[model samples]
Target: MATPVLPRSVQRLIDEFARLPGIGPKSASRLTFYLLRATDNQALDLSVALQELKERTRLCSVCFNITEDDPCPICEDEARDAHLVCVVEEPLDVLAIERSRAYGGRYHVLHGAISPVEGIGPEDLRVTELVQRVAQGQFTEIILATNPTLEGESTALYLQRRLAEYGVRMTRLARGLPVGGDLEYTDEITLGRALEGRQEV
Candidate 1:
């Protein structure tokens, strides 16, 4: 059945919302209607926030993470371990690592992983910039913190080969079972990695 006649402005908003990833037509319609019924300040706040998000954020010139400044605070901080760099797939991955507070090093955001199926490759990412940074900087180690997936592995391997000539030590994030997960429910790969990475207790 056709959708009931909606005003052009309302339909436009619904269409825009539907264009966003994971937002279906029904969800888009609901969101548009919700904003329509919301207070003027609320809707205006959302619009302004979106506008500022685009206008104020840019990829950091050093690490390629989203930031309002060129080098970003992490790259600028004197307290951070400048000799260590954690390389990840996206800006969100940087955020995830930061929340853990277990690492006090810098970061390099690739924006994406190698995925031939998606037509994304080394050139499509920030690999060249990373290589240049390594060559010019005094980093002692590059931590491959990419996701534990096929594409992530491929990207890490490619990076390892490219940075091999620099002789900088490279390390991968250890994979294992989660603390709350049971061994019986764990996949074979996770179990194997956990065993391989086991520490003396």
Candidate 2:
């Protein structure tokens, strides 16, 4: 018996699948075969959507969120409270908070947190932009909604100390958030409660 040879096209698909997070080589091979058995339109649609995602999306200039527009809809929203800026670790965090329907303020997405092991420092995030915004003295309160994990806590603490001289009210999310959990994974009800119970930094 001889081993079956995968075509170059199939091998390319497997490579792409492997590039996705959490998709090991075995899983990638499985996905490639799954797609091969799927309808042609399904695969085409997936490809088109992936292409459009990169072509149509860009970082929001104001909040640094992934959006179709430069400023993002949230940054341009007049109904939200401009005096309050909820700072979070990622764009997904913004979505999570928005889903709660409890926060009515604007947002600033940090993109990442400070992690020494990961070689991610404050310079690698949107921290400088946040400092500039605070220097403008336009916001009255900054809600540090970063996750409750060690890295998240460290990032929040660093921001607190750095912005302390800005004279604006600084706050942190309430302590009831599950320890070591990502904000994006938390339930809206729990997130809402945490927001409501936010305390001064």
Candidate 3:
């Protein structure tokens, strides 16, 4: 069999693209070719934007959400209800809830849910930080907005037990969402109704 004749730079770009989720070798090649045909300024702008994303972004210390500053805008905003905290599996999930505009509480990003098969346990997540936050007794309500998947349910149950000592009211999102669907994909209207109709877990 003859060896492929791709240039080193082209091969490298293909490999990098393949590493991204949902991008296969064929799509990667298409993207690389598209970028090659794009104006130099377009590629340069994309490169600069990617560089600045990592360089300028930081995790908010309070909510653990991605932000340019230590405390995220939601955490810093006085108008938000500090007495309630919404717990989600990822930073994107926080954005999802925010888009609904029904939740006025602060948020805690767990980063990941409890995936036993994937070796992701409670210790692997931001559970300790949540415990500390609950101990502070600042929040009276904690809404477990983790997805409606098995791992998400397990995480919420675990948190419910762990946080019981804090005396803060605990609730979970209404289960009208399709099981195993990512919260990030749910529309704002559905998510808003889910939040509003949340029940004690």
Supply candidate 1's per-residue lDDT for 47.
Answer: 98
Give the residue spans of candidate 1 off by over 4 A: 1-4
Candidate 3 whole-model C-alpha lDDT, 0 to 1? 0.91
Evaluation by TM-score, superior candidate among 2 and 3: 3
Instruction: In candidate 3, list every pair of residues with a backbone clash.
Output: none
Tens-digit per-residue lDDT, 81-124, candidate 1: 99999999999999999999999999999999999999999999
Most accurate candidate by TM-score: 1
**Which runs in model 2 stand beyond 4 Å of their true positions?**
1-4, 177-201
Model 3 TM-score, all chains together:
0.86
Q: After superposition, how far is residue 15 of candidate 2 from its true place, in Å?
A: 2.2
Which prediction has the highest lDDT against the true structure?
1
Q: What TM-score, computed on C-alpha atoms, does each candidate reach?
A: 0.95, 0.84, 0.86
